[model samples]
Target: MNMKHVFNSNPLRYTAVLGLFAILLAISCTSEKEPLPDECEGSISLQTTIGSEANCGQSTGSFTVVATGGSAPYTYALNGGTAQSSASFDNLAAGSYTLTVTDNSGCTAEISVNIANQDGVNASISGTTASDCDTPNGSISVSATDGAGPYQYKLNDNAFQSGNTFDGLAPGNYTVTVRDANNCEVSLQATIKSDVVFAQVKNIIQTNCAVSGCHNGTTFPDLRVDNNIVAQASRIKARTGAKTMPPSSSGRSLSDDEIAEIACWVNDGASLN
Candidate 1:
């Protein structure tokens, strides 16, 4: 029989052969995908300042790390030091330091921070003072010549208020002192006073009206006078002598001299001027 005739007669067998060729072609076209690049390394940065150029004992510094292309949660170190986040050191001797950062991917970067010895001592303490006057409420300020952070401050040698500011401080003399990160200190004195005469009223209230067993919070007739001297005087001195203050039995009435002073103060129109 002829070859053409034989092939046509066995069409089912030919179909099976074609199907196997298609399967082989599909397998050959299956290409593998490329892999991704490795993660980026972590990095570190450092900042520093010395307390004084003449003194090496007053240096302060801090360091931070930024991680990239690495796993979450990186670690930091300084001059072989170790920390989980940012790190700070105070009163360090002036010198050089190396900060290193390592990420979860085991990548690392480093930076250098230099601290120079100090040369001059700081003068003055930073601070301001105010009188109970109303003109100028008060002011908050600082005095510093040089050096970085790690600062400490005090008001009249008392604990310093944070945020580098104080408000509503009673009017009077005040001393403020500030020490920078390098332990260099600077101080300043300031005075704030109000023009209003009620400034004196504050003292009067504290001494007389607000005294215990008097017009204090718990006292009877509850004459809790504020900065209003006129109101206070009206309550203490009634036009009718029968209303004389500090009833005879009260045992703590204002002395004659004290009453006379209040009368004069009121007659003066309670002028703070």
Candidate 2:
């Protein structure tokens, strides 16, 4: 039979063959479609607000990591350090740092951060000390040549105190720092002369406070005890200045000169005789 005549006679066969070819094509297309890879891609940036450096060699600061053009749910790391979800870091020293951000797709972006100290705080201090064998009284005053106006003061790494003048300090070497409103600081060392002896303080306490149950072992302050003399100097000075001690009804109040003497003693470090 001729090819054309055979094909025309079996139209059903041609239809079946065409249907089979269509099915095979569909299967091939389905098999070629593989799962796509997780594409991680993005960029990172750093923003910072400079933190004020504390007194001495220590410093403080903070920065933030900002990320964009990345997949959702990103993780952050600092200088290849621990991975943290937080984008911000605080209380950092003055120096350089790096931040890296990674997205869910394993794509990473990095940024650099540099920090420097602002010399806004330049402070100097001077003080007078009354150092004699009889009396050891001293005072210190601080001044700032730089930074903001209205500064505060601190002594020997203690908490920041208001005002630049410190009174009733003992005769010794002291470290004083001036901190301005901008939180910048400068430190200075001042030596207060100690001429006042512990013998005088002992005599004064025994003569006035030890009598009539005041500052004796029975009293709350108990000044007769030598161990806590230095510790109570400030409080003793405060009480004496306020005229709250030696109760008015006690019939034996301390004289102004006597109170001043106590201040001098405390300023001299309330030394042990």
Candidate 3:
């Protein structure tokens, strides 16, 4: 056959085979592109919330760092070089620091933190006052102003409940104290006296019947002006009749006038009036 005749006879088949080969070559080229570099391997990021920076005293703050785009299980370090494993730090000293994180992919990232010292806490007691003695319903309220919370209270150097009212306390002097969370305390003094009639009777009885080892509570018959007044008066009368009221020894005896006063007080219905 002539050359021209042979080429024309199979042109359609040769063209189809060439087209299929070109399509396969295109597919292979598309698959060869290197997988997009794995999203920048071993990336890390950090965050921080700092406490007050001036006069630190119980102030606290925290920071956190995370590794992304890297491998599992990243490591952390603080102050640019200090090594650590935990991703968080708390209540750190006041200062500046740099947080660095490294991922398993060997990628590292850093962040800066400004830590400031906090102002010292201060506390003061307000609205607190010493209470009078012998007051049936006396109270002193304590309040803290411009300071931290959690306050405490005391009375007469004894622990007392907060916002407590001391009632029916006998006539005498008292001290009230208040303390704050920081253990700072303030104190005040108050005096209370019995009412007119009771006060007069108390004074007279204390001067006469309440002599040491005599009619006192520690004596044979424990008698206190605030308690067992009538019983004590009867005892005194019996002792006076026997001329034994003004005990000679111990240098402790009531004068004749004082004795008369006590006896009159007892005879007058033992009335406070």
Candidate 4:
């Protein structure tokens, strides 16, 4: 007579077991939901820094990119540059740039670069001038402002030579070029002049004056090309220009051109040919 009671007695128990199974299934599904971002891949971040310009003539600077929060073995690429294994890029000119870094997990990090080239190398001239008679062997000294030093010099398209100076240059027009370590270059014109030993005057002396008995030995100012020349160029011009030189026996009087040439020679810094 208790058959009905037996069936009804387990109804609540069966319902509770079914409810518990549903709760367990829900919890399992919630735990298995597509894993959080970090579980499979990490968020990517990039840090960058620029290196100062070191190589002079080079128009570019250097920069570095670092990546974090991704898989190992990263690859790097610049905006217009090729992909490289390392995060460092060299010889990049002064300007703004972007770097992209990719990790093994396909995650990407981007960074900005700001490099400075400062002013293109600036050069200054500070050496002595060259002239025809005096200081014929003069040299020029050059210096740089804003680039790697120990610069190189080029004269008239000649090969580059180390140092900031050009030496022993002859009197004339010159195109001087200065280059820095980075190969950056600047050009300028340089003129050399000398105030001594005018060839015309020398020829005049050797032809009309500088005679064996006149200015050879006992005479002052040695009016000859090879008559023991000295640093008396100004004195020679003073006397010659004044028409007090070349006594009667020394031949004809110097023409206006001849006198002007003497004055020019004395005023040109007296460089020797």
Which residue pairs collide, candidate 2? 131-195, 132-195, 133-195, 135-196, 136-196
Give the per-residue lDDT digits (tens) of candidate 1, residues 225-245: 553344445444442123234
**How much lDDT does each candidate structure score?**
0.49, 0.63, 0.51, 0.62
User: Which wins on TM-score, candidate 2 or candidate 4?
Assistant: 2
Question: Could you tell me how far off, in angstroms, the CA of residue 188 lies in candidate 1 after the best superposition?
Answer: 1.9
Give lDDT tens digits, candidate 3, residues 138-255: 3444343433446566768677566534555544446555555654444444444333344555575566556664556544444464645554555655565465554544344655
TM-score for each prediction? Answer: 0.27, 0.33, 0.26, 0.32
Off by over 4 Å in 2: 1-188
Clashes of each: 25, 5, 8, 25
Give one digit per residue, the lDDT tens place, for model 4 in 33-139.
22122232887888877666534345467877778788978999876367788978887654345678878876777776655446555565566665444235666
| Least accurate 10 contiguous residues by lDDT in model 3 | 29-38
Question: In model 1, where do residues sit more than 4 Å from their true spots?
Answer: 1-137, 197-273
User: lDDT of candidate 1 vs native?
Assistant: 0.49
Residue 117 local lDDT, model 3: 33
Q: List the residue pairs that clash in candidate 3.
A: 42-70, 52-116, 53-116, 53-117, 54-117, 55-118, 56-118, 133-192
True-vs-predicted CA distance for residue 98, candidate 4, Å: 42
Answer with 1 or 2, whichever has the higher TM-score. Answer: 2
- lDDT, ranked from best to worst: 2, 4, 3, 1
